[model samples]
Target: MAQITLRYIPFKTDVAFLQIKQTEVSGIPLYIIFFYIHVYSAIFVLLAGFTQFNSYLLKKRPTIHRNIGRLYVFTILFFSAPSGLFIGVFANGGFYSQISFVTLSILWFYFTLKGFTSIKNQNITQHKAFMMRSFALTFSAITLRLWKIILVNLFHPAPMDVYQIIAWLGWLPNLIIIEYYLYKQSKK
Candidate 1:
């Protein structure tokens, strides 16, 4: 993920994914700004998320876990989610894709915030459930791209069709898996 994100460094608006978003970059006055904000802040969120699920960190270095968890939650709430929500409005693939992205941003914010508040309230079970859901959503950042590659390789669908599909595919399966896991945990 870091490797993928590095492309945006020494930023240029005409590179990689932005190459396709030129129309948005040109027309949606704040699109470029929010795009960069989402791009930059998302790395931190992903990195913070990577550290948060380590059992060793949680057991032996809880302070580190807590700090990183806070970083993940706060960054999502303040930076990534808002920027995502903004950019999602002008998301590629038109209205349905826009709805999917916007819904994703809103749900991401809700789950992350719920996890944070649950932890603060010392509701460990609730926190774990919500954080699992939150992390699944975070994982969408990777899954989205991976799905795009696989779909393009195997099926060669139109770019916008792929975009529209991935807008939901990116996160839906992750959320479902997490929900299923949570249900099993509850059963136990």
Candidate 2:
């Protein structure tokens, strides 16, 4: 996430600094702004989410946990998810990629909202379940990059083709695995 931030910080001045060439050509200033917000807030989401799951911190200093949780939710709801939805329509790899991103953005927002409301209702188990779902979606940022590297570098698939696959692969597996884990935990 830090690497992405460092790479993108210069993009404010130089559109050439953009990693995705397609983004440069599409170059609507509004889209650029939203994309920047999405990327930046995503980093915060990742950072805030890291501490959120720390059992020791959560148990010992729940106030801190709640604070960070609030940050995470706010970042996603106000910045990340909305920007993501805006940028998603212009995502590369055509309609498939666009659909994947749009759906992911919506689901990310939905799960995070559900988690927040569950906690507000004092339903800890439901809150945790929804949060797990939300974070699984959040982790797609990492997974997407990883899949890109592997698919592009190793197999040398066409970038658009690999992107189409990774768009869904990125979050689907994460969500599936988390659901499985949640199911198992519930059984126990």
Top candidate, metric lDDT? 1
**Residues 18-110, candidate 2, lDDT per residue (tens digit)?**
556455436676877887898789999999998899999889999999999999999999999999999888888899999999999999999
In model 2, where do residues sit more than 4 Å from their true spots?
A: 11-27
CA lDDT, every model vs. true structure: 0.92, 0.89
Per-residue alpha-carbon lDDT of model 1 for 1-188, expressed as tens digits?
A: 77767888878888888999999989888888899999999889888898888999999999999988988998999999999999999889999999999999999999999999999999999999999899898889999999999999999999999989999999999999999999999999
- TM-scores of all predicted structures: 0.97, 0.93
Error of 2 at 180 (Å): 0.7
Query: What's the lDDT for candidate 1?
Result: 0.92
